[model samples]
Each structure stands twice: as C-alpha cells, then as structure tokens.
Target: MPTGVAIRDVREQLFDAAERVLLRDGRNALTSRAVTTEAGCAKGVLHRHFADFDAFLTDFVLDRIGRIDARTGALRGSAGTGTVADNLTAALTALFESAAVAIVGLITARDELRARLRRDLPAGVPVLTEAAELVAAYLVEERDLGRITADADVDTLAAMLIGTAHLLFADRFGTPPEAEGVRRIVTTVLVGVGPRP
Candidate 1:
C-alpha cells in the first residue's frame, strides 16, 4: 500500500494471489482489486508490471501452465517404475489440488483473458492442454516400454485421461476428489489399453 515499495517477485505474487481468489470466490470474483488485495500490494503494482488486468490474467494462467513442467518431468520419470494407473492418479491429484481447475474455469469464463492467451497458447485449454501433452508424453514412454499396448493412441489416451480427471475434480471449489475415487477412474480408463495380464 505504500508508494514506491519494492515487492520481490511481484508477478509471481500477483499470480498466486489471483489463484487464491479464484479458488475462494470462483471465476466471477477474480479482479485486479481482489488480486492486489490478496497480494498485500497496492493496486498500481499490478499495472506497473503488466499492461492490463487481462494481460495479468493471461500471464497468470500461462504461469500456472508453465508450472506443470515439474509434474511432467516427475510423471515421465515415473513411467516404468510404478503402475500406470497409480502414476496417473497421483498426477491428476496434484494437478487439480493446485489451481488448475479454477484456472480453467477462469479461462473459460473470461473472453478477454482467453483471447489474450490464445496468441501464445493457441490450442486446447491452457492448463489442461499442457497437462494432456505431458500425459501423452508419459504414455508414449510407457507404450515404448511395453507398459502400454503397442496399438494404443497415446494422444487420444492422454486427452481422455486429462478430460476425465478434469471432470472428476471440477466444480468442487477447492476440495479434490478422494484419492481412491481418482484412482478408480484412472484404473478404469487404463484398462484394455495396458499390457495383457
């Protein structure tokens, strides 16, 4: 609130604040004021860093999407070491437990934010698309390793996995599905596409 006060990692702070607002109040309540208030920074801090509120939001979602890289490495790294269903369940749980679902909701409900993000992200839902890509990459690794069937379409399977997980975790505000519930869905979806017992 003070004039000329330096905030470290201002962009990241604003993104985190925005995510918290999205999780707490849903899509309609995310605003520049809300984010600034949550971040404990003056409203001008956001404008000083980003061109506008929508720009801030677009970058916010992209930042969240970018954060998925750690998950990708971890998920891909787990390919042959663990059961495919369990790995998927864990990935889905981590993704939704973060702001992924609420970020998707914000992306869908805001036209300006969507349009701005389209130039950079360009296809599929931003957070979901990145998640699906990683899922596809992980599946391809498994398929190559014989954990998945040779005939399986990794891309389609990835989409199905991400989509199903998204639905299972959607509309719950901040509460994620029970781990068992997520695992059950993951197991059901992986059936027949996995190696023959």
Candidate 2:
C-alpha cells in the first residue's frame, strides 16, 4: 500500500537523522523524541523500527563502525598503486578522516557506552590490529622487493603510524587540525620509515 511505502521511507529518514544527531550532538541528544523530531515524524515511529533507545543506540554504534570498515576496504584497493608516501598518506588519511568527529564523540562518552559496546559489539580492535599488521607486511615486502630501505623496522613503524593516527583524531576534534597539520604528521612518519626515493 502507499501508506506502507510512505511509512518505510519515513523510517529510513529517521534512522539517518539519528546518526546526524549523534554525530553533531553526541550521545546526550540521541533521545527517541529527538530522532523522531529530526526525521519530522511522530514519536511512535521510532518504536516501529527499533524496540528501545538502547537497541537503537547499539545498532547506531555498530553501523558507524561498519561504515568506517567499508571505507577502509575501498581505500585498500587503491593502496600501493601510487607513489608510496602518497598512497600511504591517502590510505591512512582515509582511515581517519570522516570518522574523526564520530570517534572523538564516542571516546569522550566512553564511560557511558563502553560497557554496552563491549558486551554487544565485537570490538574493532582486531580490524585495527589487522590494518597495522598489513602495513608492516607491506613494508617488509617493499624492502624485499628493493622498493624501500632495508633497515626500517616494519612493525615498529606500522605501530607508530597507527598510534599517530589516534593522536591526529584527538587533535582534529579538539583543535581542528589543518591540512598542513596532517601532512606534517604523515610526512614526518613516512620520512622516518618510508623509502628514500
């Protein structure tokens, strides 16, 4: 029925609007009424899709992580195809860019959501660890292929890149890191660990 279609459309709109509210205002503003208002729907619409606020919040957090994972997968396909530093910078930047604000908001509210995220969601740690490990493997491969300096400590350098990304995320939300700011950090890490050419 046309009414059914309209209701489905409105539900989709509400879900998206909730994400925007979470991103902009953090967890404090993610009430059911707020989401419905943002979606221009009545309060009851939220319960039609989601059972409760906690369920909605749980799904929202997982959805955000899934989005970032998909973005990383896309970036990986194009990685190592360009100049090493350029590709590495692009890959790493893609990992952190849009998710920075959301991540910062989540981290700042970790005390409230940490236990729930831990219990309900698979921690993103494995994916993050895998990413860093792949970076190390790539460095070792490049060195073996004579594309990079032989002396670089691949794992250490990979860890440094990952650690620096965390710092950059913090800086981005707290102080609004500039283009030059990110470039400086990336270039510094690459210069120390990347190929001489």
lDDT (C-alpha) at residue 9 in model 1: 90
lDDT of 1 at 136: 93
TM-score of each: 0.94, 0.69
Q: Write the per-residue lDDT of candidate 1 for residues 92-157, one digit (tens) a residue.
A: 888877788888888889898888888998598888888989999999999999998999888988
- For residues 26-128, write the lDDT of model 2, one tens digit per residue: 6677788888888777777678777777666666666666666666554445444665556556656776675545654554565545566667544544235
TM-score of 1: 0.94
Overall local distance difference test of candidate 2: 0.64
Q: In model 2, which runs have C-alpha deviations exceeding 4 angstroms?
A: 1-5, 9-12, 107-112, 119-159, 171-175
Enumerate residue pairs that collide in model 2.
Answer: none
lDDT of each: 0.86, 0.64
- Highest lDDT: give the candidate number: 1
**Alpha carbon lDDT at 126, candidate 2:** 29
What's the residue-level lDDT of 150 in candidate 2? 83
